[model samples]
Target: MSYVLAKSQNDDIHNAGECGGAVTSIFKYLLDEGLVDGVLAIKPGDDIYDGVPTFITDSDDLIGAAGSYHCAPTMVGNIIQKYLYDKKVAVTVKPCDMRSIDELIKRYKIKKENIYTIGLNCGGTVSPITGRKMIELYYDVDPDDVESEEIDKGQFIIELKDGTEKGVKIHDLEMEGYGRRNNCQRCDVKIPRNANIACGNWGSQDGWTFIEINDEKGQELIDGAKNAGILETKSPADPAVEGRLKVEGIMKKMASKVQSVKYPLVSEMDEWNRCIGCYACRDICPICWCCENCELNKDYFTLEENSSPDPLAFQGVRLSHMSFSCVDCGQCDDVCPMDIPVSLIFDKLQKKYYERTGYVAGVSDDVKPPLYSPEKTEL
Candidate 1:
């Protein structure tokens, strides 16, 4: 995709209002102008423990849109399953989530004409809970001891109230490699080519968000923004944003280097042993799991109700059987109370399945999941 010169900017691209502030403002503007019935974006609340997806209609309801990233792609399916019949909603989603939407439409679950999609350019998102733990373990202090943390100067600075501090490169942290969802590593779709409108750090060189118009509807929205004086045209290259390009490049290279390293199934089993039979992995997976009653909970696997050790040679084998279908979203890893690396086990399995069968999950809506494909095809 070629870059276009648009709004002028000389400020740090990260601080650009459109990429962060303007996109959020536009959500409010749409609500005020009645352009969309409502907008769905991230809303911050008391649940610092877990981020909740919210459906908002009024401009007064928007919160924390600035923190949007590529975390929850499954919410699109949740919306389609629930609201596809009776609503025309504007939803903000990351590049991967938008791809899921495209897949949903092909499944006849959602209609393109009935929805407006705002694509956010991703700078990559980490599981805040996991990242926070990595920090606490590194510093060996109560997490509350951290007054503030800043990522700059090729390192992350952890500030303490005691007027003492330590610095670690963003890469030096263990959670850095674990930051991205596995599906995202195979993804190179930086911009949603199918989106009505797309914005992110990639569109503009300045700290400002680069807005791209992809369709007549998107252009109309841009016209409305321009007419309202909420927008302006600027060159793509702003020195402040350009200066950070090297840093972004370094992070991307590091991620790529890790991607090239081979992780095999033998290593995965060691990781899987950390799983204390907690089925949080199954609950967090966002794929085709259509079961009214899971066998894991039934007498089929359990020895007895509220009973402990197995009476026989077999303990339990449900996780081994079910984990093969996992999509490697890493939500399992993030949600585990025990802090088990279950997603790592699934990631290795997924890699093996992909290598042997050449099947990838959620790549296209039109394509049936590999397991459901014809037996002859597998043969």
Candidate 2:
């Protein structure tokens, strides 16, 4: 409901963090005050490209978790639902991550009161495998030598360990099948308003982060940090606020252009014939939590015919069951052993469902999808 331009007061935090270290400083305040048991965030793994989601219980370790990881696309919501449901935690989430969390909260799978959500505005994310290949093929650099990566002003930029930097137009990289994930390229939810607070560098200058406090918890977070003397805050000027809006609009427009072209279905793609039936797609999905009693496992729908199961029998059944709730996070495609565009069909169905019900999968105000809510049925 309100916006602030903020930066960390700690010199180490400001130097270690992206934008302004506001996010890291806020997490430090939460941990120091015992507000949460831990902060779940992504940190560098083997390298900058390998983003590992870490649960930091100590404020001293929070600085290591700072900065952005565009090539490290990990699903935070599914991890919480499976592992940290009983714990009180604060988490940083992308739009897709928040969407999944929103749906889980609605389903009573995640307790809304137990978690604080810090949403990050994402232009898009790149696959580590694809990113490495793209960097070598286009940027002409060794992917391992790269120290950091960022997407800004339509360019995918990278900094080397020697302090050299390189950039390429994302459109050019994507045009040759090498940029962001397909789902990310078409994602319309650039900012997660459903999160308690959304933070990013979109509208701010070199040393500040633009924060949008969506709820009481978010306001409390800013107030607490500012009062603790770890953070400084002020209202963003008119041009800063408008610039943020303009950037958001441009990102949404790019997504609209991607969506204007129709996405293909699983039935239309022949890649499904290569399915090895490992079921990784189902396992990776944040929304498909019915692993114990999935209908796809029933004898009637069993895939007993080698690796080539009938698409209609395999994906078709899941479509009827959960496609309406697909957040378009693209985990299905990422985990598919057959290289099938599994999320595409699910996203297409969700969009089709949207066309009829005006209910967006993860961002809707509705308590449940129309299919699950009899009173809200469109027909």
Top candidate on lDDT is 2
Candidate topping TM-score = 2
Candidate 2, 1-379: lDDT as tens digits: 9999999999999988889899999999999999999999999888887889999999999999999999766578888998999999999999999999999888788999999999999999999889899999998899999988999899999999999999999999999999999999999999999998999999998899999999999999999999999999999998999998899999999998887774642464466566666778888888888777886666666556444345556666677766678888988899886778877777777888888888897899888888788687444
User: TM-score for each prediction?
Assistant: 0.64, 0.95
lDDT of 2: 0.87
- Candidate 2, run of 10 with poorest lDDT: 302-311
Cα RMSD for candidates in order: 6.4, 2.0
| lDDT of residue 82 for candidate 2 | 89
Lowest summed-lDDT stretch of 10 residues in model 1?
Answer: 307-316
State the lDDT of candidate 1 residue by residue for 1-379, as single tens digits.
Answer: 2232333221221242344355665565577688777777765344332446677887666644444433343455545545653576778766656765665564566667778887765544456565467666666766566644444454556667786887776556634554344444433344554677776655344335566667787776666765665555454556544543554565556555555653442354445455555555555544433324665556656666764223221212434443334444455656777666565555565556667667544443335545666652642
